[model samples]
Target: MYMRNRTLLPATPERNFQMTAKERREEIWRLIRSGLGSQDDQARATGFTVSRVCDYRRLWKFILREHPAIADGVTCEEALSLAKEQGVKTKR
Candidate 1:
């Protein structure tokens, strides 16, 4: 006789729409802080291309270096906005 195990894995809900820039950046930051430093790993986790992950990583690195307060949440949305206001070139 053969028996099937009756365990089910939890599933995440599907997203039909793309994440906003803010949401994407936040997710990338979360994944980075989770300690998966490899761009490939981040891309797989975020369902983004490796190059896209690299772009977000570069943005975060720039923010951390040039504007730690923004990176650390002086305000939500300040990172990109402030960077633009400062005339820093950043790819969204």
Candidate 2:
């Protein structure tokens, strides 16, 4: 014969999720487009660390080099999509 279990645990509330790298990049781009120049402003707007914002800047430069059209009023989402389509890997 098997013994029955009796203990039950209470459910915990879920915490808010953090932004992913792609989302952070997109947010940073938006801030830049909206004229937020400083890294501090980007960090505040995107909730990313200063180093991560700097990383995004580096990635943006690389992306711009590979795709000049991205600098010509292309949306951040479109640029990211094009980068993926071209198999350009973002730094992890």
List lDDT for all candidates, in order: 0.58, 0.58
Error of 2 at 63 (Å): 3.0
- What is the per-residue lDDT of model 1 for residues 6-77, given as tens digits with 9 covering 90 to 100? 322111224313666566566766765444446765665456678777766666677788877556663325
* Lowest lDDT block of 10, candidate 2: 7-16
**lDDT of model 2, residue 23:** 61
Best candidate, TM-score: 1
For model 1, the local distance difference test gives: 0.58
Error of 2 at 11 (Å): 34
Q: How many residue pairs clash in all the candidates, one count each?
A: 0, 0
Residue pairs with clashing backbones, model 2? none
TM per prediction? 0.60, 0.51
Please give the distance, in angstroms, between residue 77's alpha carbon in candidate 1 and its true position after superposition: 3.4
Model 2, 23-80: lDDT tens digits are 6566677665554547765565566677876756665676668767757576667766
Instruction: List the RMSD of every prediction in angstroms.
Output: 8.2, 15.6
